[model samples]
Target: MREEHVQDELGRLLAPGRVDATAALELLIRQALAMGASDLTIEPRADRFEATVRRDGVIVPLAEGPRDALPNVVNRVKVLAGLLTYRHDLPQEGRIPADSFGADLDFRAAIYPTSYGDRVAIRIFNPSHKDYELPDLGLDDETRDRLSAAVSRPEGVVLLTGPAGSGKTTTIYALLRHMLRMDAERRARRNIITIEDPVETLLNGVTHTTINEAAGLDFARALRSLLRQDPNVLVVGEIRDHETARAAMAAGLSGHLVISTIHAGSACGVFSRLLEMGIEPYQITGAVTAVLAQRLPRRLCAACGGRGCDSCRSTGFDGRLLLAEFASMSSDLAEGIRAHMRLQDLQAIALRQGMVPLARQGQRAVEASLTTEQEVRRVLADA
Candidate 1:
């Protein structure tokens, strides 16, 4: 059946339009905006398109699409989102808004281009006006206080490391907000530059650049220019290449506080990942200050929340909190890196110097009852 022909005649208590593939697709997203669902998934199979909302770590099936109409539902979403012109063997992104909610969703979409049929996943980005507050990140007081001091430094690289959707970006935004509050008068007079792939958020009072390695407007060049601009603070979305890492060190050495994220499993892994990316151990030692690695787990629902239930959505989870591993640079760890020792060796030294691994952070959350042991094990296992 077509979306226009979808009947809202389902039982009142069963959730309206939930079984109608067409209307449910729209209704589910709209409901996500209404209920503040953080993520949405559309699973297209050989037999049907399974559309579900990820609320409080649970998969709530909103609608089931007929196999024959699977393409239509997927294509409609892409077309409506401005993601793609038509179905093809390529990946794309599309984002459209529902006027009723006045919410803008940023979709990081992909089409597998598989023989099983094109599979699409949509990760929503909800930019809240209040998203930049530090206290609002749901971090524990201990975690918050430690991170707060790291940001207080005058010159050094404060790295934020985590996997995608792990709230690393949120932590960055929150920290920036915290800085703006702490030294608004002083910060107002300083130059702050950022090099992000596709600038996620728009921060006031900062010079932001989008990275384009193909055009030579990459992080290395941007950092060099940002230094010339005499920035007091710097934010780089990702540091994967040697050039960017070198530039980051140069800036930090020249009295700028550099901030960036690396794709590492633990806070300690940040060092190894950097070395793997080709940064010399000495350069890595010279520029680092603190590494704050975190992951976002679902938060519990105060209402309709339970240990386990049909409505709990079968994931045995509710909402999310942060599992963080925070490690600050010390003289001993710096000496290990300077001596060209292995990252594993440096990590052991870091632990000896009071660095907390991210896995420990997750375990603390589990012990606090903020999340389940399974949730902790799922994320911390990588550490």
Candidate 2:
């Protein structure tokens, strides 16, 4: 259909109420497709619905529309996603396709029923766009080289640690892509598997596993089962428990380059985190290889030429940069965590052992002033 016809159809499908259309939504969709968007949000209020698209570690508002008109928009989305009825009281998932800028777009839509009406969120995953390069993640040469080396190891553990909103998953995925393409001659036959409660990235080659919280498909059980299958490389989505920790340590020791992630601010913190989960100290020092802790910092968009403009919405930052904390096993931090030392003490010793702290990485962001002191302060705050 023509562009005007598509917009007309969408307008007609919407319920009768205040209608507001801006170029923002179009830009939002374009930006997300070009980069990668984890989720999309529509905030409904008394007067209007504010649409925000999260990209590059920041939330940018796309447009504002009449509140009464939102339900109609929600209805349209529901219909397009093939939902019989849409409820604003529970979580719902749906899929839809839309045409934009000459290309057909595929979107995975989810709606969560909220007090202020149904909040609509969408995660757009495109299978057709097969070309993904690790360097596209916007890593500098230094960080890129370090990350490449860490994941290329034959038999060791590399952990990506960060809080929930951090860029942990993105970093891990980059490393996984590296592994998927590491071999030059393409002669190596390797199996890459991931265990996630809800797998995010739709990778083609890797065998994806989902955990059944009730039926015992949890990480630990899954990891044990995975080992028996003799996976050449394994990825445990997150090390959330002692069993999973033990299993991952075992995977590392068995000469499989097990790449995993954790919910910690620093890489070295993984050792103490494992111990806190009840894994033995000796297991950590022997089996673990390196830890990668990271965060997503709001990045300045090169589009507006990094200058303040109405186009960029004046926040100056339009994208995100990855801030990482990599902890390699050292004679110091490894020995400290094994002895049940405080993370602070372990970090102090690890610093001397060449451990890279998040603060140090944050400082680089600060030096570029790509990030502010407040941003760094909030991120560096004690857990």
Candidate 3:
């Protein structure tokens, strides 16, 4: 459809009187996919309902409709997701299969009760998207090689650390796919199992499981059970709690190559985060292989020379590129962890051992004209 036609249709669907919620939602989803959005949020306001799509770590407004149309639209989404629409007093989450939308995409729907009304956020996943390969992740040669070496190990934990929406999950998935290809090339068959909250992608040779807290199945419990399944490689979605962290370490030490993601500010911060989780220092030194921290900075718009343009939504940026720092465990770094060294001391050790910092990578990107200094500063301000 043409741009003008799309705008007219959206206007009609969101008009004041009598709205077709189903058609309105379909348009929003189509628009989100077209914009390469990671999430679509429909929020309730006092006088109107607004829809926004998150594209490349930035949220942009998509549309707005009369407040009276929101409930019907929310109900339509709940029905599609197989959620309990009648219960608006509590939060609920469910999945909408790709086939339902006639697209190669997966939608995860989450609804929470708000003072104004129920707020809905839908995460869009394209299972067939192949842009997440290690070569295509925009990593420098040194960082990529270090990550490849770490994941090539037969036994150890490879952890990806970063804040939310920093592409940690994408990097981990790429690593897993690379491992699978390597195993195939070597004529080696390995059993790989993954425990994820929603099991985003469907890999052909991997066993994927999702966390079902309602069924008493969480990450910790699931990891403990999967250990007995004779998996050569285990992928825990995220190490959030003490039990899960310890379980992952045990799995790593027990000859299984464990891969996981954790929330940390930087590569060296992973150790401090694990220590704070109550994981023993010995386990940290023994089971961990490497920690790769990364961030997504918007790529400068080449077409407009960083000027506002229609191609870049007038944002002076087209998409995002990965900026990463990989910290491979060395004897000195291991000893520092064992000795309960301060975070700065450990970071210093990592730097001395040839580990690059995220700030330096950002500076490199800026110098290379891949991104703006302002963009890099905005992303790594906390790091």
Q: Highest lDDT, which number? A: 3
Residue pair clashes in candidate 2: 56-320, 88-113, 159-292, 299-319
C-alpha RMSD values across all candidates? 4.9, 5.0, 1.6
Candidate 3, residue 45: CA error in Å?
0.6
lDDT (Cα atoms) of all candidates against the true structure: 0.69, 0.69, 0.88
The lowest-lDDT stretch of 10 consecutive residues in candidate 3 is 1-10
**Candidate 3 lDDT (Cα, 0 to 1):** 0.88
Q: Model 2: runs farther than 4 Å from truth?
A: 1-38, 46-48, 79-88, 94-106, 126-146, 196-205, 209-218, 301-307, 368-383
lDDT of 2 by residue, 37-140 (tens): 55568777767676676655556555555567677667666766776454666776666755532446567677877677887787665444323467876666
Error of 3 at 96 (Å): 1.3
Stretches > 4 Å off in candidate 1: 1-24, 56-62, 94-109, 129-132, 138-143, 185-188, 212-228, 299-306, 309-316, 342-344
Top-scoring candidate (TM-score): 3
Ranking by TM-score: 3, 1, 2
